[model samples]
Target: MQSSLPPPSRGRGRATRERSTVPRSVSAHQEAVRSLLQAPLSAAGPAAELPLARARGLVLARDVTAPVSLPPFANSQMDGFAVRSADLAAGRPLPVAEPVPAGADPGPLRPGWAAPVMTGAKMPAGADAVVPVERADPPRFPDASAAAEVLLPQTAPGTYVREPGSDIAAGARALPAGTVLGPAQLGLLAALGLTTAPVRDAPAPRVLLVATGDEVVAPGTALPEGKIFDANGTILHAALAEAGVEVVDGGLVPDDPGVLRQLIREYAPSVDLVLTTGGVSMGAYEVVRQAMADQPVDFLSVAMQPGGPQGIGTVDGTAFLGFPGNPVSALVSFEMFLRPALSELRGLPQPRPVVRARLAERTDSPPNKHQVRRGVYAEGTVRLVGGPGSHLVSALAASNALVHIPEGRGAVEAGEDVTAWLL
Candidate 1:
């Protein structure tokens, strides 16, 4: 049975034509995405206290202050003899006192003696310098029981001593807000004996994903005649998960406008975003396009290949983005537009790293549209992975980078520099 669709509103098709007549530049579309997100999502949320292990890759919501000075107390930076600099002035052999092993607390140094100290061991009171073991007259740590007098070269005070607060002062800021908690940042917190971190309250944006196509079926199920297994859902699910988005699968919707509209209306209230694959282009069975024909959504054809058809609108006040059905096109649209916009809105780091690299082979690109080609980038060189085809899912998997051939440039010669985004 066919479902009735709303009549197209005035200026809807004209808007699409006007947008398609002049292909939207990559930067322009990205700007539009950014403009749609006026403020960060965390602004409306509360900060969360997460354990250090769970805080990795999250932005800090507040400054982390050191509870105590780094190194806590004065300690030896090397395995040597902790002695008064005055004792080494005359080049006289000072009798070694008790040895200070790591985690051990020894008494103050004697008037004319030295104390053997291990690396990271606390320096005894009255000790002004540490003579490295190799610099001692015996060039070794003496036996604890034996009467060992080790001559030491004259050393300056504070030499080889890791003074308290050298790395970080107590109550001082160890990390500032908005800092992404990477390994070094987490290590700093760990060194300060912190078990948890106050991270930005950027909760994962819940998304409702709808794959619309009568010929598309879920994987692992028996394929009906003239039907293809759905890849857009799988691709988008994994991508959204990697981007830290909570996805509520809306399953597959057929080419029925009423069913699609009902699904959007059902999930829009609980989701921050709605994403659909297919039914956004200028086709007869474009159910999503027809359902939103009277709505605020604008469906247009972008100038780029593999992902030219695009739709961005709001369904029931929830942001909606419609991508092409091809696996590679859907994935590319997310990376090129949605991901960066979401990152800005959610305080997440930009997922794709863009870098310039020399092309390894000559390649041609269509004029007047930015061609994004999958490639293998290695050691400052980028080679095309496969032919330019939106259905080449395997090729996209084999590639590690996306090479951008700019508009107005038809062909790029080998060894020429081009911009690439690292996956």
Candidate 2:
């Protein structure tokens, strides 16, 4: 006969009480972080005056009104002569009084004669139509005495003349506030005689990235047994830069609680957001969790492989996040959470591209977990290039997309339909 062992102690609950805190479930923690990160921003000050050349990708802060009508005045659209329809009714040669070569004032036009005008040339006063040089029968010459006078064979009123204000009216709202400035917008501003554009001031957020691990070595250093090189810092730095973030790489902080605490105390107050990798699990030496023990942090174990662990909180109003240590896990976590949060703060749309593709091979995913498998999408089919191991770098390189397999799903047979989010 065997004796029954005493009931196990509820150490987890006791530990929570001892620390006066509890680890929030994955969903609850994710929701809390999402809410804080996507909070509405307060209204900013008036628009900034930026040079038109430097205003690309910025939102206009105020409405721009045209100062004057487009074309400024009635102009000739063809290179020919400007004359009244009555002058051509006689079907006789008309003398050219003056020349209007685009930007040159031809002075007032006499009622019974024609003025030689070039395309874009301002029509002389009292002129009502423009006869193209090609349409005139024997085009006229500069000197009336030495010229073969042309007959206006076609006499149509208001023909070949661009009326003033036809394209845009004076004092009209050219572009409303919040208009995203692009090449077309810049061209419109230039056409409206505006040398400067009113654009929203870019909000630059300073970010601090801290990559933590004991087994992680710098990229240039030699790797020992069970040790790997760090890539998250470089990858995340580039990603943040592309997203318009100003990042200062805080470098690696090993899984040492005292050092981690010191770094956080020093850098947390200086940055708008603090990002880290590794040390948020229930391991005995989880430095990130240990360091923030005195501070506010919500630990979460999400229902996702390779990126299941996360921590989010604030240290004196500065936002902080801890992601898993695996390279793919870190990137995937960022794509799902941080990127969207930052885009929301910057008033820009999220960058996830979704499309449907047929699976090229059989695949299976665990129940109640969203499996984001990397694969290559081609010819309307997605080929799984690598195993679902997060540490597989070659697999990551071979894939260009993440196939989102929903929870509680089983094997996906070949040629089965699935949705993929392009990276």
Candidate 3:
């Protein structure tokens, strides 16, 4: 029978009734993987330039310097007359010169004259102020043949003029290294006229996924006696995809240890990591544990409920992570341990969003196990969705957060503060 007792603490000896037997803290397990993995398994190559359109969600490997100042030259910000501020100091009518439409380079402003400059047009030389069309007496462009003059109000220098380098300075850093390219970042690159950006060469990590157990069968197929659909494989594949990792399905392996070993050997060379669900716990059909018994892997129970049985080791130079078979346990294990580590390696955000909230009702936890309970968190309160069973796939789906109860703290009262991980 599977042991109900918690495993021994990682660094400490045996587990006692008073002390929790957590083999590793959530952080410790993540750190171990970081230290053990020498190179990123999914790396494509060295950093190289990528088109701006294809750079979204990629990290910038180098700083991007502005080739030219934003608004490269002085331009007009309003469709109005560009006049020397000194000439309009006393609100006097000035002769209108040739109109400067956007994209046209009109001659420099004639002394004692106004030039009709459209918005976004380059400011004519010797012009420092703009009088909006509405602010003019007739509020309309004068005829060039008529050589009309219009009255203007006193104006200050630099008004309505977009000065050179106002948005970004030339040769200045537009984006620093390690910036994750998003809409705003891509827009900036496009505005700067850059066709490509230097991004990290890391490709999405490739994983070989294996599901074990003779009693498990594929979904949408006929159900034989004492058989369950293979939920773990589907759940894990979806989770991996959502995390930006690539998965190569190894299909379902039966309880035979020799066949499991042969399957691992076949896929290990092509993948960066190997992830297997089921057969790592203290059960008669624990094929994964028995097959890897002679290898360097360590199969141990963590002091965490729903996902206590865990394994981390390398098989033929490929790292392998073993997760519990229960649907909820498998999903929670990925969220708590594998997700954070993989995200960090992929230059994505770490430690999924966590928030504090009050408990909606009383809850019980095992004496020496940290319990991750699925719950619906809203309006500053978190309510448990279902019982503490690890097979409650329906309840897990209904939850939007995971409420964490620390080990050795048996029960929590209603209205008490608790930590929750947002999904």
Return the top candidate by TM-score: 1
Predictions ranked by TM-score, top down?
1, 3, 2
Q: What is the overall TM-score of model 2 with all chains considered together?
A: 0.68
- Highest lDDT model number: 1
**CA shift at 376, candidate 2, in angstroms?**
3.8
Cα shift from native, residue 29, model 2 (Å): 5.7
lDDT of each: 0.84, 0.75, 0.83
Stretches > 4 Å off in candidate 3? 1-22, 39-45, 53-56, 73-166, 223-226, 346-351, 354-367, 375-388, 398-400, 408-422
Error of 2 at 289 (Å): 1.4
- Tens digit per residue, CA lDDT, model 2, 207-276: 8888998988899988899988998888788778876678978898888988887887788777778888
Residue 66 lDDT, candidate 2, scale 0-100: 96
User: What tens-digit string does per-residue lDDT give for candidate 1 at 1-423?
Assistant: 001111212222323412355666666666655654443243536689999999997888878889999989999999999999988888789998999999998888988899999999999999989989999898999888788889889999999999999999999999987788999999999999999999876667888999999989999999999999999999999999888789999999999999999999998988888899998887779888887876677777777877998887677777778898889999999988788777766665566777889999999999978799999999999999998899998999999998888777899999999888889
Q: What would the per-residue lDDT of candidate 3 be over residues 1-423, giving only the tens digit for each residue?
A: 001213323332221212134466554555555544436543535788999888888889889999988988889999999999999866668888889989998778987889999999999999998889889978888887786989888888998999999999889999998788899999998888899999986777889999999989999999999999999999999999888778899999999999999999998988888999998888878888888876767677777888988877778878888898999999989887787667666656554677899999999999777799999999989999999999999999999998988778899999998888888
Look at candidate 2 and tell me the lDDT of residue 67. 95
